[model samples]
Target: MRRLLWPAAVLVLLLALNVFFTPSFLAIQVRDGHLYGSLIDILRFGAPLILVALGMTLVIATGGIDLSVGSVVAISGALACLRISEDAGVLAAVAPALGLCLLLGAWNGFLVAGVGIQPIIATLILMVAGRGLAQLITGGQIITVNDEAYKMIGGGYWLTVPFGVLIVLAVLAITAFLTRRLALGMLIESVGGNAEASRLAGIRSRGIIVMVYAFAALCAGVAGLMISSNVSSADGNNAGLWIELDAILAVVIGGTSLAGGRFSLAGTVLGALIIQTLTTTVYSIGVPPETTLLFKALVVTAVCLIQSPSFRAKVFRRRGGTAPPAAVAEEKARVREEVPPDGVRS
Candidate 1:
């Protein structure tokens, strides 16, 4: 129940906010056979954050963080837009765009996993320099690409559903499959739980870490493509700006602690949805657009605090009058197991 509390709270908060701000926010329409409005927009815009959070989950599960993702998004979008502008064949350019993303991921992996650098510090270098690379690609200006292929990636739809959202779902499905069905979650948890122990156990901990970082870049690449498609242009300075904050917030809000350990893809999805809903609620309630971010930050901070062990315990104690019997028993059992017996077990 403790593990479930945070997510459940967020769900209720989402519903409440929707009910108060937009009466029809939860109404899913199949009008002309299409879903639309704020709800759909929430899902659509939240897709990229969902993708980023998926990769962040793996990286965090490995006891690492990738700050380079926002920059990677900028670079990928800039490069792809530039290529299409050059009139390079669609496949020819997109292939290289993807290759570049993969290579960037590899570079991040090499630095953090192979060179023995702190993940945050290692990714920081790219986070700073990568934007400059993107600026160079776009000649310090937003570049518009009138490519049909690129448009399909961001703006095209299938059966009246957003293709970008579908892509995000596909990535989510892949992540869920890999982590849940393949025991990858166990491996990641083990690695994050104890990197040295994993190394001693002959696990390819470094390789795993590298793969996670690389996957993060790949995720960022997809986000960049979608963002560029939506605008029909790439702005290195603005594309995915501050998205790292949202990604990290989503992960934390989903109950994936930043300190690292286990991860939940489903929780991450719900987290992204929560964020989008909150944003929608804020906008619908007529808050100034500039203040939207301030509100988001405050809400995220509140979530992080609530998820903190100390805070949760405090809250639990304050509400102890209504403590559930099952929870009390579980707490007692945990205490007994944690404490040594009065005498030796033998």
Candidate 2:
């Protein structure tokens, strides 16, 4: 709960800012039995990000990172759109795209786990090559799909809520269940904490690492479908571009350490929302398109600094605050032990 405090606070603050700038930011109206508002738009646009970050949380938890998710997103979207353009059935289009995503994941896992390449390098291989692969699949042109069913995956409504929102919720629920209701979370954490120790203890660290990478790719694939389906086309060059950075940022902002160990799905969700909200806020405030990146970078840096313990300590000291109670006690204990009771130093 405490770990989620900063992200929750930041999200609320951003939402409040939105409300102030755009009075209708929270206004939702039902038209044709479907909810509509800026808030809904945020959720809809942020859905893909949520999926990507969820997978990233697990990979980061395993002390590994997947830099290829953005590429995977492109490949998945391209393949799906290409099949649909070729008049393939919806299931036929989607199944093969998702299967290819898994194979891409396997390739990443093989390089990292089996071949012992560094994770960043292993994943980077795909990151650089994936766009080309997507371009090749689409013949360097945007593949447009006229399939309404496919578009529904990214844009339609259900029960007065965006279908994309429902998809996000379903993914979130399933991931939470898998991590919390089973030993999978523990195994991943163990591998992250100390792979050699976990291996000694009979945990299949390699297998777990491979599985996580594969799972991350699967999540990226789903996000690809959402993105391309939303637009009814796959632009291999631009689909999911730079999203990997955003997913990594979301994972970091969600209180997950790059060093690995414990993680919180709820935190990642909030982080994704915060990011989406921030993007919306930028547009609402009319930041120049040319300067938007600079503005966003500044805001992100501030958030990261605010979330840094060392930075907090510096701020606290400048405000005339002492160490925390536990730190004070530990320091006193150390001093007492260092200076013998009768003034005799050991």
Candidate 3:
């Protein structure tokens, strides 16, 4: 509960602001046997980010990053749509697209795990080339599909709630079970805490690293399917542009260190919701389209500053005085223990 304070507070603050700006923000009504409201829209639109961030949490926990998720998203959607456009059955389309995603993920894992490439550079290789491959698959044109069954994945409602929300919930539950309910989470933390030490201790660090990267790619692929299905089309150039940045931001804001170690899936979900709410709030407040990005950046920066312990400490020091000697010593000790000798950024 203590670990969740910042993200929870940020989420509440964003929702309160939305209520003030849009009186109907909290109102939910049943329409055609389905839920409809700003809140519902936030959850629906945020599902993709939630999925992507969940995978990212694990990758970051392994002291690695996957910059190619956005490109994988594009490639996933493009391949799925291309197959569908060619009269492939929906199952046929989905299976092949996921298989491709798995292969793409495996390739990334091979680079970082098998070939010993730095995680960033290894993933960046695909980040740059994957989008080009997506373009090639679609011939630089959007491929549209009209299959209702496929559209249900992203746009349909079930039990009066958006299907996308259900999908997110299911994935979250499964991931939590896998990571927390078993020893897998412990092994992952060990690897993140100190890869070489864990390796010597008999943990299969390489296999864990490969698994996480592949999982991140798999999540990105699912998000891609949702995005393409929502609009019934795949635009390789625009499908998931910059979404990787958003997922990274969500992970960081949720208290997951970029340097790696512990993580919280619930916090990541809240962060995603806050991001989605912020986007909706910007439009509801009638911020000019051209300046929306600027507004968002300002708000995000404020949130980050508020969440930073160092920033808070500095502000408190200016207002009052320094911490007791014991407290300062403890803080320094904790930092020294947590940070690696290589000066890895957290």
Candidate 4:
């Protein structure tokens, strides 16, 4: 319960701000009986961050980060848009695009895992260079496609639920299955908790590290497809600008430590939701655009402080809370208390 302090605090703050600034922010209204309003917009548009953060949870869990994901998003969107044609079959268009994404993923994996380069330094190469590659692919122009099947990746509806939301949910479900059903958590923890110890235990840490980066690239690809669908055009610059910050912010806000250890996918999902809601609230209420970034920064800092070791200890000691000796058990107990009944804790 205590482990969840920071994420819960962030969720509460996001909700409170929405309610105070935008009276109907939480109220999901219907226009002509179809879903409409601030809440829906938050859910629909925030799907991209949710997808990116899901991959980030895995990478950060292994004591690494992938800075090139934004670039991957751009490349994936560009490829998908460039290949869209009135004559191409659905599979012809989408499969090749996703294949390119997987190749990029493999490349990232090779650089980070095979070459023994630091995650940040390795991903940075792609981050700086991949955008230029994407622009070159598009001939430095935004490509708009009119393919119906491809357009549905982002703009289609699923039984009144947005396809974008469904895609995010599908990825979340798969991730949950891998982590929970397969006990992959133990493998990840072994690697992150102590790489030397895990290697001694015969766990292939390098492969796992590569897998994490590859998985991150895969996620960015999905996000790119969805984003381009929303706009009906592939604009590399605007598709996922500064979203790496948002992904990092979501992970931290969701209670996943940047230092890397145990992780919570559920918490990350909620963190993404909170971020979307905050942005929607800011826009709905017409707050000065200049203050929005400042406000978000302040909120992130506050959440991080709440999760910091010093503050946690201070609150725990002052409140006379005691933790069990086993580190894993202690963290789990702490997380439970921090998570609200209505909110997910990372």
Give per-residue CA lDDT, model 3, range 3-122, as digits (tens): 468888989988898898888899999999999999999999999999999988999998888999999999999999999999988889988888888889889988988899999999
Q: After superposition, how far is residue 165 of candidate 2 from its true place, in Å?
A: 1.3
Which residue ranges in model 3 land beyond 4 Å of their true spot?
Answer: 322-346
Instruction: Give me the overall lDDT of model 4.
Output: 0.77
RMSD, one per candidate, in order = 3.8, 5.3, 2.7, 5.8
Tens digits of per-residue lDDT for model 4, 1-346:
4556557677777778778876776787556535776667777899989999999888888878888888888888887788774466656766776777777777777887788788889888888888887888788899888877777788777666778888998899999999878968778856766666678889998888777878888888889888887888887666677787899888877777676767888888877887787777668678799899987777668767766665555566666665323443555565664464656532
Clashes by residue pair, model 2: none
Best by TM-score: 3
Ranking by TM-score: 3, 2, 1, 4
Instruction: Tell me each candidate's TM-score.
Output: 0.89, 0.93, 0.94, 0.87
Clashes in candidate 1: how many?
0
Candidate 3, pairs of clashing residues: none
Model 2: what TM-score? Answer: 0.93
Cα error of candidate 1 at position 12, Å: 3.6
**Once model 2 is optimally superposed onto the true structure by TM-score, how far is the C-alpha of residue 241 displaced, in angstroms?**
0.4
What value does the lDDT take at residue 209 in candidate 3? 91
lDDT of 1: 0.80
Q: Write the per-residue lDDT of candidate 2 for residues 185-254, one digit (tens) a residue.
A: 9998888877877899999999999998999999999999999999999998999999999999999888
Selected candidate, larger TM-score, 1 vs 4: 1
Instruction: Give stretches of model 4 more than 4 Å off.
Output: 30-34, 312-346
